[model samples]
Target: MTVFDDLVGQAQATAVLSRAAAAGAEAVAGGRGAGMTHAWLFTGPPGSGREEAARAFAAALLCPDGGCGHCDQCHQVMIGSHPDLEAVRPQGLSYSVKQTRELILRAAGAPTQGRWRVILFEDADRATESAANALLKAIEEPPPRTVWLLCSPSPDDLMITIRSRCRVVTLATPSTEAVAHVLATRDSVPHDMARFAARASQGHISRARRLALDEGVRRRREAVLAIPPSLTGVGECVSAAERLVKTAEEEAGVATAALNETETSELRKIYGEGSSGKGLNRGLVRGGAGALKELEDRQKSRATRIKRDSLDEALLELVAYYRDVLAMQFGASVELANDDHRFELDRLAQSSTPEETLRRIDTIMRCRERLEANVNPQIAVEAMMLGLRRP
Candidate 1:
């Protein structure tokens, strides 16, 4: 086993990172090195595993035996528990300046145990302008033993000045075969189910795993897929829109509920309610209430973002269904993402013309744009469902 095992289908990137890790080890050993840099930018489309690659590189850099995957160092890095590695994943709409400044302040310190102190930021493109500026200072004058790993959807998503300071790693979307192989091998999913999930997810590794392992996820996806073909009239379109929004809300709640409770409990302990603190100090209680309020606000915003993302996933699933229909209509030999639903795809293809399929695809895309722009989700989705009706 190797550190790059989990980074499926990214051979070029794995090789680049492996060489860089070796150079980092040599650098610490007082030898000449190659392909070692203080900062790295990993760019890829969603589900391409940019953050996964960064974590593997961190493990390799920290492991004494050059990233022996079974070592404690590698395990710690993989689970994000290593003392020398800090991973920042923004929970809300953006990474605020305050949080970035705090991270920068912590990053100025030297490594505690590992050869290098690694700061990994997933979705670095979500950093606010002021936060990005704060991060820029750290990259410009990083500590000798500090490394920064930034992940984004594309190089262009980041400020040019910041991108210029970092070595770039690009990852391609993995093929359906690669995704299915990983699902079957790593998650122990049945071969046929793994193949179905892989095709449905369109190379999204996490979604593929979830779709393979979770019946509810598959059911939700089936519902989304059914909506396109069921939009026979105004009432059905409106009902489908409501169902989609409600399902998204439920999904978002499920995602955040446990996390919210854990955070609240931690805060309570910090504020003197639990054994971690002395019997409630009045002044501390007042401060704690303010902190709790701020946390709740962040949680609300996070919940909203989660709902939007869930809705978008369903929208994309509908889009893929039509894409497959169009592919069938044109006799395209390319792999279909919804191959598990070939019967439905055939029915849709036979029922609708290519122009209708293309128009419906456009409607779904527009709904996505509308959601991103903060338009009412129900309104946009209702219109999209109506537009998807057979003409």
Candidate 2:
């Protein structure tokens, strides 16, 4: 139950952070912080636990007993309530330069409750270029007690100047068997279901948990998998494309609805919009209009990000299914990601050549690239599905 225990398949990273934590403790005792870097860049593929590892590192650095899991210090860090820690996770599409400047100013302060002031920044890759430049200054001239833990999918995702100044911590993807074991033990999922989720997710821990626990998620995924076999005609392929886009939009709305409401409610309270016991200043509401407008704009941007993520996931699932088909056509011995759909997979594999399967996968990848380049989701998916049409 140590802080690092939750990070599966990251022994190398855990050891590095552990020694650094010891060094952090030594530094706090009026000695040099040997083996400790002022900044760390945590890089991993999606669901490889970049944020989790960084948080554990922060906990170890701040905890007096070296990350004793049950201590108050560790518990506070888990819930992001530690006085000396600042957790920054951007909900919008990008972290703006204005926000970066404000954050840098705040991070310049000394530690409040621990030996180090820890800034755990998730999705550091989403910062705009201007925002990254602003961040580079702080990292270049960091405060003595400040520690920056930045998370991204890859080292190349950030500016060279920013990444070179930080120690890199790379996490490997958890194996399917390892992910299944965690789901069965920690989430209490049945063994068979856990294995299926792990295999389907291709080692994405959070996605495996959701697939195991949520029927709605499984249904949505099944629909995406069904697309390849059902693309019999041009009209049907177009229809499937529309359905996928609609599904992504609905999923994003469902995911963000509660969060959106909560944020709006909190902002209203800050502006004194509700609970009027009479004689409240009418100017209060008027003055808060701009703030409310800004909140609305940010929420829209967040929804766009969520929708894009949903669509991208659907696209990846499609790719996995075709990959299985290609593997079967070539008689590869690897396990199929969509083994449960063996009947459909078999039929598709027998009907198509390996080259055709490859072309479809390439098309899906191109669609993903189009989406990343800000092309319309509907157009990109439609083009992909049309390319995948059997006849």
Predict model 1's lDDT versus the native: 0.90
Least accurate 10 contiguous residues by lDDT in model 1: 274-283
Per-residue lDDT of 28-68 in model 2, one digit per residue for the tens? 99888799989999999888899999999999999998898
Model 2 score (lDDT): 0.91
In model 2, pairs of residues that clash are none
Error of 1 at 160 (Å): 1.9
Q: Write the per-residue lDDT of candidate 1 for residues 316-363, one digit (tens) a residue.
A: 888888889999999999889888789989998998799988998999
| Top of the candidates by TM-score | 2
* Per-prediction TM-score to the true structure, in the order listed: 0.94, 0.95
User: 222, model 2: CA deviation in Å?
Assistant: 0.6
Ten residues in sequence with the least summed lDDT for candidate 2: 277-286
